[model samples]
Target: MYVLIFSDAGGAAALLVVRGCHTALTAVVSNRSNGAGGNFFCEYDATHQMSNSKGELVSIRALVEFCSTTNCNSRQSTSANVFNDCNDQTTDYLLGNEVLNCYECTAQQGKNCNEKDRKCSSKKYCTKQIVHLDGGFQLSKSCSNINVLGIDNACANYDVVTNPGGVAVHNKYSQCYCRNKQLCNSGSSLGVVFTVSMLLLVHVMSTVVA
Candidate 1:
């Protein structure tokens, strides 16, 4: 697997692990002008950037990217050598293969954002992320195509927004869903969360009383 983990000063970094699949490494690009676009770099095609219909250059505020393998993001796998095995190339989109259509969103300050389609590559998984913060939360869901080598549900404290000009707020991604089927991450996992948290709270209270 080819892993690339880039950390931003604002704390918006991702661990991407690409294996034998042939798909471009694409990202949801947003600039300071509040413009949104897509950028991808692939082996067969030259690196390309997408802009709004007006074709203006905008400053990048945040970028969220991913890959299929979970090993790339593992806690113990923190090494720069993760990208040692990757070049550039994409396998042709196969027919009848499970091309996932996932719900995609990026939000800050607990405000909701527009949801769109995220057509995933073959053998990829759908992932959902819910970030919990002080008295509020943010939500995002997308496709992940990566090999699984270890546990997927791990958490770390990371910042999401660098600027706090009432535009974006930083939050920690607290929940993740990595599933193989299409649209598996479309539904919210709130019920499970409430139950688990309640149980933990009860246990803690009991321990305190004891």
Candidate 2:
């Protein structure tokens, strides 16, 4: 004879086991019981049917007896279940893609440098460029793709010759630091005069080349 007692939301339900008729009694109790849905008959007897159940229930007796030695009816968990109640609703707009945000400004001595935030388009990179001149330097920070300055590599120096005439004009630009992170190249220490000089130099170079 076996007695099965299981707990449910309302309360506990019981089943009466008759010797040599365990299977019939278990099936009847399970079908009539008002509680969770599972094949508990396997736990009610030592000899259980090899039915295609959840594979958790081993013997009907084990379930009916609630054997202290055996660990049955263990709770399972999953990623969704664990984080189901999380309140953080933050979503990534880029969805794992790179966000190239940069600070944009030009060097200009004795002049006010207008720094602004520039949201780079997709497939673009942040750049911090510095151009050395006769007695000053020009600095520009913005977003550009690999083709803008023909920078095949990050932070590599290069030269741009705008004019090659009687008085040749040479422009040397230090490696333009490129990065994939957002807002990585926003700040620069070069004075406003430097930016102004750089712009003037660029204008003159363009005019000479023309």
Candidate 3:
């Protein structure tokens, strides 16, 4: 099992747990943005931790990219290689096949983003992320083996608007995961397809606790 923890300067936190991946590979990446900054850290159980200073989004994107590029099943016997062998391997071993095709794109392509699809293994989900930053929002789609730490088939949204040191700063990040169909991440509002009730429940629980 792999455990990832993300926390920002504003006291917001999120946890992601990835299971059935290779046993040896482990990594922890963290970043501090210009204003109010954020930190992302993840660790795999059975090996040493690798750390990076890049942003949270970049860290996750790197993991997804790594999964897409490498075949973990072929490297299981080798020693842990930080970010290289972290892709989930158990599903492919058990199912013996790929299951879904997800729409793939990067935020950098801007308006000229191309239509590309990636095959996802079983237990993996098609993922879409929308990030609202200073000027506007950015979108990216890919396949991910990581799920929200506790909730199943859920979407996560974080909206933080803070005036730190009297400077206005706003950051909004949202991600959705779905495994029901192929190319499920093609819509603008893909997050709505996954249940947001978990978020609502968390809000209610926090309110009651306070």
Best by TM-score: 3
Per-residue error (Å), model 2, residue 191: 23
Candidate 1 has which clashing residue pairs, if any? 22-90, 22-91, 23-90, 43-88, 68-145, 68-146, 69-146, 69-147
Q: What is the TM-score of each candidate against the true structure?
A: 0.37, 0.33, 0.45
lDDT of 2 by residue, 1-210 (tens): 223322221222432222322223222211212112232211221222111122121222112321111343232222223222211111121324655555655554454446553344432445566665554666665544321222222443445444334344556655343443556555533221111122223433222110
Question: TM-score ranking from best to worst?
Answer: 3, 1, 2
Q: Which ten residues in a row have the lowest lDDT in candidate 2?
A: 82-91
CA RMSD (A), model 2: 33.1
lDDT of 2 at 135: 46
Worst 10 residues of 3 by lDDT: 29-38
| C-alpha lDDT score of every prediction, in listed order | 0.33, 0.34, 0.40
- Candidate 2 Cα errors over 4 Å, as ranges: 1-95, 112-119, 147-153, 158-171, 187-210
Off by over 4 Å in 3: 1-98, 108-110, 117-123, 162-165, 188-210
Name the lDDT value of residue 120 in candidate 2.
40
Which sections of candidate 1 miss by over 4 Å? 1-82, 86-96, 116-123, 146-173, 189-210
